[model samples]
Target chain A: MRIEAGRASRRYWQDLWTYRELLGFLAWRDLSVRYKQTALGVAWAVIRPAFTMLVFIAFRKLAALPPSGVPDAILVLSAVLPWQLFSTAFSEVSGCLVGNANLISKVYFPRFLVPLAAMATSVIDFMVTLAMLALVMAWFGYAPTDKVVMLPLFVVLAACLALGAGVFFAALNVQFRDFRYVVPFVVQAGLFVSPVAFTLGDVPEAWRWLVALNPVTGIIEGFRWCLLGANAPFYPLATLTSVAITLAMFALGVWYFRRTERGFADVI
Target chain B: MSDIVIRAENLGKKYRISHETAQPYRTFRETLAKGFQRRRGSAHQEEEFWALRGVDFEIRRGDVVGVIGRNGAGKSTLLKILSRITEPTTGYVDLNGRVASLLEVGTGFHPELTGRENVYLNGSILGMRREEVRRKFDEIVSFAEVERFIDMPVKRYSSGMYMRLAFSVAAHLEPEILIVDEVLAVGDSAFQKKCLGRMEEVSAGGRTVLFVSHNLGTLLSICDKGILLDAGGCVANGNIRSVVKAYQQKAGSGEDLAPNLIGGPLKSVTFRQVWINGEKLGGSQFSPGEPIQIRVVGNAAEHLPEAVFTLSLYAEGGRLFTVEDRPMTLHQGEFSLQVEIPAGLLRPGDYSLALGARTAAELATPHDWCWGTDLASFELNEVWSANCKRDLHGMINVNARFTRENAPILERAAT
Candidate 1:
């Protein structure tokens, strides 16, 4: 009889590929569960950001915040689309490890999939939000720009930034349940810190250097650049900072997640 | 040898058992103070409590090994390490094949999902491919007896149905190594039997199984080898029967649970004051005519003394019952009381027991710590009456008295 194969070193990448089906299954399961027994159904996915955009419109027109070069509605909608996607993705993934503690504790799989699949569910919402974005842009009579081609690139950066930052929080969330309370504050703090409704030009020259350091400044500007077609867009330094920050966060996130993942099952 | 499917050397796991400060830095002051007092130890002095220490073992392919242990033993830690749920603090383990674990059924069950969907969900969790799951779906439903309700959301099913569905999926996944931990206790007797049968089938089909359970009978039936883990370590390993025999010997005779089981203040404080005032009294054993006074003196931390103090005679197979108050009334605290086990009621049998505690509240397990795992058991052996046989042990009674005076003679003469 042939003996069983011995354990191999460095089978992680292949194993990840092989387990793609599980990731698909987990994401699908989450979507199904999220929509199940809901009154408004999937409309909430569209309505959640749509409602947030309304809030931004109020902040602009009623609250006397100036339009950031584009129509108040269009600018707010675009920023909200990305912000909601990132927040939803990050929040879902932050709790993903804890939510799957049972599965994590019982069996072995590429743990990257847990967080990845968590982020995957938000992709559904992201796509839905994209539909809303295109509909709004069409209604607003804004022509498509060449910068639009780079939209997907900035989108990837946004996801990488979220996925990366979310990993550390998720790991810490398990050990310190206080993170649950802290998470909402961080999300809110980030909103004020990012250039969601305002343009980078709105910042005084004195603080532009500081604002440039914020990873989201690059991302939001990248998004605006893509949408507005370089009317005053596409700074190389900002893009570099965005890409660098995204990479740094992704690298740190993966490492921190892997390091803390070893204890997740027990601590969770 | 099947290339030694599992191997471990010097594996150790340390857990910080704490119910205090969340982070390593205890306080803001501590963090700042430590930097100034650099000569002092760091701000975070985490206590290292090791759960598993230098645990080493090897299992060949197709070996069904039972891991036996008392509560707080390292059984779960070992399983967690082998399952790759957590990492060891030191050393390493190597596995030659894919391993699956059923730490509990429905590990990620979404109650809203249909049974059919959950089957796929649970199978995916065990790392089974969809095609593999689809192939086994029919068998799984049939085994779980949930075929008719497979399309319905699991939340609607009885808990029994949920457990069966969950277990069936795990069973059909067919991983190379399966680790089971106390999941058999979920379903009822028939389902447990079915699960045991399925476990046998899997091992027979050549997959290695590692099982942890408190039920000795179940372990003895399924496993060919046994490993007994004690407090944070393995005390015995090897043949199942021999190890089980050694365990039984270690257990000794299950008797004499006085202080450990019963929690209440005895006649201690204020007895001198009350004894002189004729208010307090204490005694161990009392005759039927004697007034037995027992004053329970104890204080409960959070819970009030709300359980009924049951004074009863138990003989033969069950508890012969009596109670002074409803269980809800007795909370936790220092309390003492008077109890009377009515004279001549106890038919002699070994019944050594003192009052423990049980609440109507739902406890996780019978052996769950709050329930008090092994309570007091006392022995009772005394002759009550000639006609009263030992066979009648349910409720006890001494002697029913009947007297015939001179007036009865006239009535007897007429008959």
Candidate 2:
């Protein structure tokens, strides 16, 4: 082991690879801890998105919102699935550093693994919710179009967005701690702002660009398009914008996390 | 020649001590105010405390090096830097082997996880692979003496059991260089002895070890070399015996025995001087069963009724014995109190004195005036008398008298 000041980013990627087992263990620990004492166990993961889908279904009907020619429940679940992944991943990643302060202060590992592993837990939750969505579709006798094969690409996009934002917020939370309060607000506001309860087409055409700025908008609409068929339009321009923005966020988060990681043990 | 397993060059760690707010997490209002102050070029003053500064050392392979220092002496900081837990603010350290640090036992053990699961979790956290943990799993369980409870959640285990399990995992770690920080102080004495034995075994296998502990006797026994740190810098580095002796002499010197006055609501009384037998005392040696006198001189800022002064005596084994509270009314200015302890009571060991005072009205806050633990320490030595035996068992001398049951009084002999 060679330790030098201001050389954190030098071999960080290789170190992360070496510490990959830590990432797996951390993710496993988080998932186990989450469902350990709960009466429902892993059912809690599916219950959250299921309840969210039901609430959105009720809201869509009360608002008399126009549907995208698909079953309302399917439409809501598809959109809500990615949003659940994003929100959970964001919240877990943001709090990862402070939550594992003991490990950070006492042991040496690539700090990025903390937020990355926390994001992995949310990904696990997303997969469980996806399976639930599949069951709901089977009940509705809705066979997804051949486009469903393209869904993994969109899942990766959502994961990247969550990890990027989570890494950034994790670093900020260590210093300001005001970000802890800010994160919940962002996740809550994101529920309405992103195209979670409704399709991006339902958004007025003039303000659609503003919604596209939110990467999750592209992810939710993309999920719907893949699972519900082309009835959910795949706007190439909007998807490209979302992809570009998500990658930028990921890069910025990594840069900021590495910059602040050296100071975590000291300040934290 | 043995290879140099570790080398630290000019390592330093600096921390900003914020005085503006006591809270570690700043509020939004404070952050905003700080931003405004920064823009105006008038920021809050923060003192920088160098936990370690310009420390340099080299450890050869198979050397068991002990790190000795007083609290806040930067020993932990140096270990942290070497362990890569924190980056040094300056300089660097190079190690040529796999390094595992046990800064504390059970560092990442989850209370809710079972022993079987936690062993894996802790093993991985210590940088062990899955296969390594699996291979050594049985040994760890047996070493901890928790084979029957291995499947049970650690939260249900007693504290001793938990500590044993944690230490067992760390002991099984096969790092070429081990860094341990006072973790052997956990569990029972038998477990501590087992841990020390395990560490010696590790060192005997030609692996380098850096151990930090306040237990001077243990360090002297186990360490081949010692590094003494004082005020964030290395003061002495040499053979274990001399290093330990230097630390003890420096620690026992009378210069640092001055009482530290902590300001509070009841700051009316402050310690002016503390003396043993009319001499400043810092780890002074006294003969067993000899008459020892402690004189405490203090100043009262104002007239006070119901002022009670107490001197608490503490043995090295953490037993506390307090002198009777001397209640006295004091006018403004200086007052002195003398306490005498007849010698034959204490055994040959280290003892410390803590001074405290409280008013009847302020009984709730006993430390309001002059509370300092281990502020001045002295050692008791065994002195042989013509009739008294030199080697005695346990801490106090009773001077027992013997009598025969069916015979004469045996000349009324005392044993």
Candidate 3:
């Protein structure tokens, strides 16, 4: 058993590098396909959040909720920005396995690469949205806060959280196709549950812990707190949850994905 | 001992033949209970069918092997294992070099992409590097005869054009081992000839090839070694001709050719073994054009006479040139006819005979009773070539006069 494990591990290492080309190919293919026949092309990346920002502004002005960003401008832009990244990254990564049935069957690649490639392509969209966000911030003349130095760390945490959950959903999608439908619903619900538009202070004091337990809630609020410096760094606790959950979800996702991957070519 | 490139030991792959009929619209609870109960109670619910069992073989560098079998005979499954499309359920395989397969044309092609884009994508999928695809890119387009349509979208190309382009990319993209499955079966004869020439070039370049095809004639010319698989395992592994012979013999001997005496909806059936009669008829010698009794025995469960039928014979070489005629005039009962055996119709060889009984209609379902029993084995002991060399195209040999001035005129005027 010991010798077999050694050999298998060595094989896995070789396969990882050997399948790198496939990884790049899948990533490029997905990116090309996303904008292939579309009218807006790469601008769709900008349109989704830009329109969502407008909707948020209308809500903020109409309802008069306590403001997060620069009232009708920068605050809604920053909040909608991360929330869009979170939604797109996780969904694309999860849908990757089900989408590329052709590649999965004919070739031997690290199954994780399928979802990882989607996750990577999504970062391109994330970068574009981030670029747009910076422009929005400049337009509103919102200066950086001291906590802004820590914003990169929060973005990394959000990526990890998305990656970990993305892997699990990819595995589940293979076993049960209904996860495709479940994923959109989860993302929609997440938009409301996280403090995307409102401040966490609005929720009752008794419900604070339950609301903070949401990994993205902490990351989104952390994004606002670090960038704006209006709210306190509740991140110390949320960081613990995000890191711990990301680590656990990562390990679980890899294990589950590998276990189910053995049967993929045959069944798919 | 030309450096062995691939080796397999006790290689086997088993699949659970899922009887789709058994699983109905039952609930998950019911399915779980039934599955467990079936697993414990009856060993029959799950039948382990090994596509390949204990296959041990080695291929050296530059060897071409033809893996031949009937449908469901594990040919494709074995290719899948070697190509690493699926893992073997047991044992292991070791290979020293890369393997690529053209199992289906345009396998990795994106229809929305342009023909030029698909060429790169498909070429890479077959294990070719980008530089290699670029180097051979022009040659591939020219060979596929689709140079004009390179910029066009693949989805818009007709099926034939798509296949031609796909085949060109696959053939041009280099690999140490080329595994092709029935790709040559498509395309026009001229195009088939082109594909064969490309395969010959691949073989000459000292690359190993494993071609899976049902065309015995094609395989006999290309493959050096042959592997004949049946049901679950290799039955014969050796030279190409001998393996083909073994497969032919197995197919011929295993069938029950005799028509049932108590026939029903079956319009016209031959009771006697056609080949057995041919054997007893003084060993298959007939005057150039002679009258022969075409015998058939069947009862008219209901009388009808517009049941047109024809008896056909094909030599062991897959030649379908011989036919004994029974014109479209219905018959519903025990009937036999003496049809003329057109002189010089057959050449000297073993042949299998089959009979077809069809009713003439727009959407008529022809009652065909073809078998090893209806087979007529015959040989042409003498052929009066009559100052012309014989040809290798079709089944029947025809006799005609050639007038010098009219020859070219006839050729020009021919339909």
Best-matching candidate per TM-score: 2
User: TM per model?
Assistant: 0.73, 0.81, 0.79
Error of 3 at B274 (Å): 9.3
**DockQ comparison, 2 vs 3, better candidate:** 2
Model 1, stretches more than 4 Å misplaced? Answer: A1-9, A63-70, A203-207, A230-232, B1-3, B19-39, B42-46, B253-415
Q: Which stretch of 10 consecutive residues in model 3 chain B shows the poorest summed lDDT? A: B274-283
Model 3 TM-score on a 0 to 1 scale: 0.79
Alpha carbon lDDT of residue B341, candidate 3?
A: 57
Candidate 2 ranges with C-alpha deviation above 4 Å? B25-35, B255-415
lDDT of 1: 0.69
Ten-residue region with minimum lDDT total, candidate 2 chain B? B254-263
Cα-based lDDT at residue A265, candidate 2: 83
Q: lDDT tens string, model 3, B40-70? A: 8855344668888888777788988999887
